[model samples]
Target: MTELLYLFDDSTECTASVLSCLPTGDGLYAVTLDRTIFHPQGGGQPSDIGTINNVSVVKVVHTPEAVLHLTDHEVAGEVVLKVNSEKRFLHSRLHSAGHIIGLVGDQLSWHATRGNHFPGEARVIFEPQDPASVKLVDCVQFQAQVNQIVTQAFARVLTENNGIRTVTWGNLPAYPCGGTHVKTLNEIGQVEIKKIKLKKGQITVSYALT
Candidate 1:
């Protein structure tokens, strides 16, 4: 297994040794490294795109055995692994925004059932205690509350026990997650709750960064 450098370091670039490089069809190669800063596509966040020795890394995936970097060209020996910083920053901001929205949902007595932090498709789905009680006005109020918290720029606290990582901000409920996030809520910038929709028993709150 590859050591995930991003877990411990904030830097988006790192030097690593190529452990194995194998062909996986379609003119692509599955490259493994001793350590990597590239975040694999998981937990609803997309993979980081950057270069390995100037070779484009098309995709990244985590397996039980190792973290694979899919590239168009083969690479070996020592390589400089770099992530597209712009994309990384956007992903972090959007993911942190989702968490804040989840906190707001808790305050409304709604339970978060799912979330997607992908840029342009970010949303949090919740199951309200009383589905009929949810309304657009309530969503607007919730958005205001979330923006207030973001303005406060609460620090994000991360802790792990028994291999389960929990993230918390101020008095908000701690949530178990493996995705990347900003160090503080203020980095999420202006959060706009685009819309709210009720489908069956699920209340979906769509959001965007302004």
Candidate 2:
């Protein structure tokens, strides 16, 4: 298994030894490293695009076996990896904001089923404990609740055991996650609840970063 460097911290660049390199397509290659700072396109977050040994990386795929870095050119031996810091920061902020929304749902006795943290398409899907809670999907009130959670200085805590990583926000609920995130809730900034919809006994809370 490739060492997941981003799971421990948010540093953007790292040097990793290339374990294997193979040609995947026309003038493209899939390179696997001993460790990776690139967060693959999974868990509702987009893949990290950057450079590996100066060759442009088009995609990063997280597979059941290892992380593959798709590059414009071939690379071997020890390689320098650099991720787009701005894009990564935005993705992390969006992801962390989704977690806060999940927390809000939990407080309302709703269980979060899924979430998407991609920019311009961020939202959380929840299964309400009571049908009455479905009526609480107010843009104004829900925004206030989310704002209240955001204003708090909650530190992001990560723990791993037996290869499973768990994330926590201060004394809030802990969740199993494999996605990238900010170090603290403060980095998420302001979250605007765009719309809330209830349909087929499920609630969808759409949001955006301001």
Once fitted onto the true fold, the runs of candidate 2 whose alpha carbons sit more than 4 angstroms away are 131-134
Writing each residue's lDDT as its tens digit, candidate 1 over 76-179 gives 99999889999999998998889889888878778788888899999999997677676433667988998988887678788888978788776667888877
At residue 191, candidate 1 shows an lDDT of: 93
* Model 2 alpha-carbon miss at residue 189, Å: 0.5
Q: Residue 72's C-alpha lDDT in candidate 1?
A: 92
How far in Å is the alpha carbon of 44 misplaced in model 2? Answer: 1.2
User: Per-prediction TM-score, please?
Assistant: 0.92, 0.93
Model 1 segments more than 4 A misplaced: 129-137
Task: Estimate the lDDT of model 1.
Answer: 0.86
| Residue 16 shift from truth in candidate 1, angstroms | 1.0
Worst 10 residues of 1 by lDDT: 129-138
- After aligning candidate 2 to the native by TM-score, how far in Å is the CA of 33 from where it should be? 0.4
- Clash number for every model? 0, 0
